[model samples]
Target: MAPAARRTRPSPGPGAVGTGPAGEPVHPAEPVPFAARVVGWVLAVGGGIGALAAFVLTVEKINLIADPGYRPTCSINPILSCGSVMTTPQAEVFGFPNPLLGIAGFSVVTTIGVLVLAGARLPRWVWLGLQAGATFGVVFVHWLVYQSLYRIGALCPYCMVVWVVMIAIFWYVTLHNLHHRHLPVPGAAGRGVDALVRLHTVGLTVWFLVIVGLIGEAFWFYWRTLL
Candidate 1:
């Protein structure tokens, strides 16, 4: 007879891959990528900055209300004067400086961005809240742009920065929300927007270009008036 066969134990079960005796996976959780983490942090920082800027502008508006000559730092040029916009009756819609609304709205956005950056798995409702706030911000920014171009007859540089930041935040948040299906838009409207964002890169580029063109046209008109 051949030598006595030596028996060897078979490998552990399917659950044994990198697992312990409890059959649970023992590998450390994969870390988020540096690029993604950086992007999230940037969003958070941008939101915080936007919120602070809006708050300061609101405070300045308050001071101006107290003293008409209390011009803020934004009173730089005729075309870029917060004083011009603030003194307008439109700024007092609902009997308050509109920047106060921006302050409050951006504060909420900053909070959401911070929580997202911190890797908090926010609930769907929380994402929906952010979407609502961002949507409102987009609407308000457009209203301000309309006021600056048509009503106020002037554009505040600081206000323009705020508008740009608001747009960026809106785009970023909306894109994220769509990717996660957190938007409340339903049926065709929702599907259409999602398809447009997903399928038409050139369309989005053109849309952004159109916004820049409008702003440039306004600047050109103002510059020509100066000449």
Candidate 2:
């Protein structure tokens, strides 16, 4: 006697990671924002790097606490000094070290991304949650950027790594959610949103360029000194 074959639900497509309310993926006129694996890899790699930077920053902070005059290994020079940035009140925005938040947030991001990479069919709400987190991460990173350039007047190398990774993840995740309709598009602005979604890489490139220009302009004196 042969055992009967058991039926199983088919997995979502490689290009689409999440499911709609009816357990189906919405196919808009535009291409999928990105392949599921692409998003997974981005999230995994970005989150992992962000977490590592945050961990290093935390260790530096701890060492600094142990010795008041301790200089972080990342304190390469005057303009790029982690020690200067760590000594500022801005480093403890929530009465604790900022890297603590990074450690917690990015760890979750990495876990979810790995799950998606393993062919997990995340729900629409989960995608929405990622959208929300990415939004917050980008906003916070920008605020830190402003504080670093204008207020703090110094850049942290480890922090810069986090900034770059955070911007990329935010940009891609937002695109994914928008294209999947998890974030939804108003009837009148549907076309506009679609266009924005299609120009994803362009948007990211321009964003990075703007940041570079700002940094150069802000630190022109020290940058020229290096030459």
Candidate 3:
């Protein structure tokens, strides 16, 4: 009798997402979409900008402490005054300068972004951890925004930059988790979630516009005077 012929499996394509033979049932392989890569690069650049702003603020804080008469370079005008904001108790919410937190948090964000861009697939747990961190960051930033608007009564230019980057980080991270199934949301909601993710830029734009409106309203007197 003739020997039985062996069956050779076809090679998977670059975007193939399965372990078994092409037709057999198998869980999807890691999702490495273009959106993911774009988000990663954005995170890296935004985080770096945030870190630089934070570092500058920290250095200015030190200089102020060393010489009470020193004014921060960012203290350009009444509406944009880091000196005034830094002196407020809110700036040291944990008895330490708030910029310290920014430096540490943004450094991690930037590192993660770099890793993602390098095509490293992080585990689900790591993605969850990132979600948590991003959540905390967004919450903290909102609180600081409230303080700056209604309590401290001054805005820091660098701090605003941090706010912008933080919003971007949080927005993208949330979308990534949802699209990649890292979030615990029900599978039934996947379609809706995907729709939201697709319109992410629109959502982000509205979010930012709302904040800008709030800022303008909060400092109406300054804006009115300028106009």
Candidate 4:
């Protein structure tokens, strides 16, 4: 009689690679797409512009404090007056100039963008931190938009640049997170999120259009005269 043969364990499949060290199901690392690289560059440039604007506004705000009759360079017309907007109480939501927040926040954004552009892959926790920061920034920008349009009755050109860059940062970061499954969603939910991100430009376009409409409508009386 022949001796009984011993059986070896089968090799793990792709699905098995999804498991964590604790044998828990996890999302595997996905390849970074080319669009992400483009967004990274955008973030770097946009963040730089935003930071510069913030720095200028901060200095201008300080100058305004020293000279009550000072005029900011960005105060071009009645409708667009950084001096008027900066003098308002809304300019300092936290007992300090809001641009201070932009200065610090945008600096971090620019640094991360530079790293990404250099082909650096951020860890999951860092991506989560970025998502949180971007979320706060977008919300804060919208609040400022409302304050500028309805309450302050003036627009700051530099501030508007910050708004545009902030939106871009938030949108692209959110899309990156979704596409990479950084958020703790189920497999099916992740697929749905991926589908939504696939048409991200559509949603982003509509979002920009909506904000633009809001701005135009908020100053409809002035806009109608230009027509």
Instruction: State TM-scores per candidate.
Output: 0.73, 0.83, 0.85, 0.82
How many clashing pairs does model 3 include? 0
> Model 3 scores what on Cα lDDT?
0.89
Q: Write the per-residue lDDT of candidate 3 for residues 104-211, one digit (tens) a residue.
A: 989998999999899888899888898898899999999999999998888999999999999999999998888877777797898888888889889989999999
For TM-score, candidate 1 versus 2, the one ahead is 2
Q: Please list the residue runs of candidate 1 whose C-alpha ends up more than 4 Å from where it truly belongs after superposition.
A: 1-39, 184-208, 224-227
Candidate 3 lDDT trough over 10 residues, lowest sum: 18-27
TM-score of 1: 0.73
Spell out the clash pairs found in candidate 3: none
Off by over 4 Å in 3: 1-34
- Write model 2 residue lDDT over 37-64, tens digit each, in one string: 7789889999999999999999999999
Task: Give lDDT per model, in order.
Answer: 0.72, 0.89, 0.89, 0.88
Instruction: Let me know the TM-score candidate 2 reaches against the reference structure.
Output: 0.83
Clashing pairs in 4: none
Q: Candidate 1: what lDDT?
A: 0.72
- In candidate 2, which residue ranges exceed 4 Å CA deviation? 1-33
Residue 157 of model 1 has an lDDT of 69
Which is better, 2 or 4, measured by lDDT? Answer: 2
Query: In order, what is each prediction's RMSD in angstroms?
Result: 5.2, 9.5, 5.2, 7.2
Task: List the candidates ranked by TM-score, beginning with the highest.
Answer: 3, 2, 4, 1
What total of clashing residue pairs does each candidate reach?
0, 0, 0, 0
